[model samples]
Target: MAIYHLHAKVISRATGRSAVAAAAYRAASRLHDLRLDRDHDFSNKSGVVHSEILLPDGAPERFLDRATLWNEVEAIEKRKDAQLAREVEFSIPREMTQAQGIALARDFVREQFVERGMVADLNVHWDIGEDGQAKPHAHVMLSTRRIEVRIGEAVHGRRDGIPHPERGGRGAYDLAPDPGPDGAERGRRSTQAHDPSADGNSGDAARHPAEALDAGEALAAAGRTARLIAAARLRHEGLGLAQDQPSIGFGAKERSWNDKDLLLTWRERWASLVNERLAELGPVRA
Candidate 1:
């Protein structure tokens, strides 16, 4: 997997100078081997120096290629002088290759400019590492001219959807239900009666409150025993103590207490054991 990065910068000539000379100066300054005096004509004049060079990784070379580079520069020139736009930068996941990153960057630039009906000759460079081990990235040089019209509109209502009338309108009172004849007095009497089957058994043979509590305690003890056994096995393996034997801790015995304090303490101890086991595994990969 590779990461994608895009960076853009503006290139223009010095004050009071020709656009051609500025463009030429910028183009020549970008060459690694070429010098101002030795390889290009801008050596003595010094009229226009490559004012700003913004190179995102892998972007420079692609922008330098004559056929494609000229197109980018043309896009920049299409924008007017007064409205200078800032450079754009973005990064994407590494799944895209160097060539793919460059293509995406070019497409993104074209879409944005086309929407504004502006054309400028921009340079895009792709920076790919040696043997392609590093993530792919790109740098773009764009013109600052403003070619598109800016429009503004006032927004009133909620953007999501229309407001619900029930929630927004004036509140209404709900009417109470009316009972049939011989109703109000009968309803009051029925509400005051006690439930006979509150105990699990029938009303005549209801179990005592103490007996029910004992049964509940017995069931809880059995469940705790099972959980203790499982926890012992996990702890033994996690600690690298006994290969097959179960391990026991103070927290397991404390379960017999039924007190909230003891139960909470045991839970904390179990959580600590879980954390220790995970820490041994080290950081997760990717």
Candidate 2:
């Protein structure tokens, strides 16, 4: 019997669930949750036939790794009760081969989700049921938020009197020495560079100018980062910020995905795909 089943749910912190854990379990791989500082090891877990991340065309390349992808989701969501992701579990026809099922799932995911600008983590599994029959399915974890990648250096201003990379490092407004933490203009580096006590703290020693350059360079290295802001937050410019690209994120949850009418439409689409694939196979050649 060919089955068509698609179920969707929100993976939210309010339910004490983690997107990182869900991704690791579905992929049967080990992943570290950067936000929770915990490790999820399911590498020995069986039944994972294929696992891959299908990022939207312009999505960050770093998210290609399952762990890094989910970790970024965790990082973007700061609230304790944030909705981390949406998990869509669908059944693959038992008549389909492993490769066929994977292909079908990937196609469905790409057309339904990726084309609409969502990052999907797809995992196909084939396990024996209690009846000793092959039960094949796939789990797709879709990011509830949208991705925005900007090209620039990260600027952390004035940590320990060190200038950030954005403070005019290339000689624009930055050609002159930057002001110190006290709002006073900085003196020449040739004079300040030798003062061990120039830092003006009780027991702290002054840092060399070159060390500040190293720190700034390190900040610059973290370029072209992605911001995962939810669509809800994007709409309300004054709402909770996901990454400041005129969008929603952590401001309010998106509701269109759970609409009864939309779900019905998705159900129909899934069934149509299954029927089309089976029809293409032509009655098993008798």
TM-score on alpha carbons, each prediction: 0.26, 0.63
Candidate 1, residue 268: Cα displacement in angstroms equals 44
Task: Please provide, for model 1 over 152-227, each residue's C-alpha lDDT reduced to its tens digit, 9 standing for 90 to 100.
Answer: 1101111112211111111111111213121232212112112234324454333232454477776885677577
Model 1 vs. true fold: TM: 0.26
lDDT of each: 0.32, 0.63
Q: Write the per-residue lDDT of candidate 2 for residues 139-194, one digit (tens) a residue.
A: 88887655543212111122112232222111101011223121131221111111
